[model samples]
Target: MTKAMLLLKFAGLEFSEDRGGYHKAPKGKLPFIDDEGLMVADSTSSVFT
Candidate 1:
């Protein structure tokens, strides 16, 4: 999750850390993004989106 955060930081995308939000993720994962009305899980997919 740390790595993912770093990557998103490097990409210059503004996002908030939802502490303990992993449980609500699609697959119980961290580093998910809730952009507008879309939720993207995983670093790779999030980057591309």
Candidate 2:
């Protein structure tokens, strides 16, 4: 997942691991966000990020 996140970072986007809610992923599972506020789960969702 780190590798995937790096890719997104390279694209000049933002990724935030959601917290304080069910929408957030597990402690270990990092949910990411894009500049436009799009949320993503795994590398599978990185496309949207």
RMSD of each: 2.0, 4.7
lDDT of 2: 0.56
- Candidates in order have lDDT scores of 0.76, 0.56
Model 1: per-residue lDDT, tens digit, 1-49? 6767888788797767878766778777776777786877777887676
| Residue-by-residue lDDT tens digits, candidate 2, 1-49 | 5776678688886656434655454334555443455444566656653
TM-scores for all candidates: the values are 0.65, 0.36
lDDT of 1 at 16: 77
> lDDT: which candidate is best?
1
Off by over 4 Å in 2: 15-23, 26-28, 34-38
**In model 1, which runs have C-alpha deviations exceeding 4 angstroms?**
none
